[model samples]
Target: MKPYLMIALCCGLYAGLVAAVEPITVAWRDKAPYHYRENGIEQGFLLRRAKHIFALAEVPAVFVERPSKRIWRDFERGKSSYCSIGWYRLAERERIAQFSVPFHVDPPHMLLVSPGARATVQAHKGVATLLQDGRISVGVVDGVSYGPALDRLIAGSANQVERVTVAPASLMQMVAANRMDYMFADEADWEYLRRHEEGLDAIVEQRFADMPAGLERYIVCSKDVPAQVMTRINRAIGALSDAAPGD
Candidate 1:
């Protein structure tokens, strides 16, 4: 065979191999300091880490913004090659999807108490006592988890719970407006809201002595995701250092 013809054939084969690799769809929601769009570009610590992990694994990925409910729905529908970052590993979720090794550790959660409910909230000694009190109402975001321990506590609590589908910042605003007595907020989330959102001055940040330890977040994907792909992702996560700030 001619040398020029051999080179052309090799080039064509390489192109075919590259074209055969399908990019995974990485779904994310709008959560500042974690995952959000700024200036029409994706930005956040978790998002950056995810991108790095995928790159290190040599996996092709395409990020798309979607609502949290929709992300979970895609998994429920058995969507292939779909993944989402920074989700808790829960039993029900495990039944529906696969999870990677934990990639991020959040700080302990704090309570955001409404100004009007300050006196009432202060009366309780800890999270347990506070949740058991039916007098104080709590607002929770729908389809969100506060880790297994806290989630169980919230479920078993006698407190009046109001579930809403809103961003954490908007939930803080609801607290300021006295929509509910208090709600759980991630330490990092509170920091971001405190610095950026207005009308939060009246909102009181309270810490309980019995609050559960911070939960680890993982890259959750549809069950159809290849085990080999997950293995690569997990290996990449293991190789990365946890020294990144705000993680």
Candidate 2:
């Protein structure tokens, strides 16, 4: 074979090999304005960004809806070729999975106070004071972290906390029903819910002066994912400047 022809043939084989790689499973849970399904179609800012990143990297990926708990469980099991979007980077998570460069940042969390507890919640000038009140009850999603600072405060506080395994919107409903005094929620989430979910008016959104700065979110993959694949994903994340599209 001619030298030029030999080079072309090698390149073709390499391309074929790359195309034969299995698609990564991108798991996401229902979190509006971040990742959620609408009218049976996947929609959310983070989902779109993740799609774009995988496209830029020329990596095949299949986005799947899985419960948040199941997603972490899969990662803990060392599932190969698995990835989840919009996860906070934490030391414990780092031990279970590899994370890409931070891709999205969220505004600081605010308190969604039940109407029955609005007076009590508003009386406190800061989140620390509110959490310290044993008379108040806080609702939290099990296995979810509200950034490190809030998590630490919640752990140290003497207030009664009710942990439930439910979607954020559902948790908001719980707050509206006065099941708990208040619960922490993202600003974006509060806006989205306020627009789409009725009865949320009964839940007053409150901000705290002591709230921590927004936390950066990243794409986390199981430990068994190939390093090369993660490198490509990170490269794509770094290359993209703006992921949002004009409506």
TM-score, prediction 2: 0.87
Collision pairs in model 2: none
The candidate maximizing lDDT is 1
Encode model 1's per-residue lDDT on 214-242: one tens digit a residue. Answer: 99999998888889889999998988854
Top candidate, metric TM-score: 1
Model 2 bad stretches (over 4 Å): 1-20, 242-247
lDDT (Cα, tens digit) per residue for candidate 2, span 1-247: 9999999999999998875677998999888888888899999988998999999998899999998889998888888889999988889999989999998888889889999999999999999888889999999988889989889999998789899998788999999999999999999888988899888888888998789899999999988777888899999887785544331
Whole-model Cα lDDT per candidate?
Answer: 0.90, 0.89
In model 1, pairs of residues that clash are none
| CA deviation > 4 Å runs, candidate 1 | 1-20, 242-247
In model 2, how many backbone clashes occur? 0
Candidate 1, lDDT over the whole model = 0.90
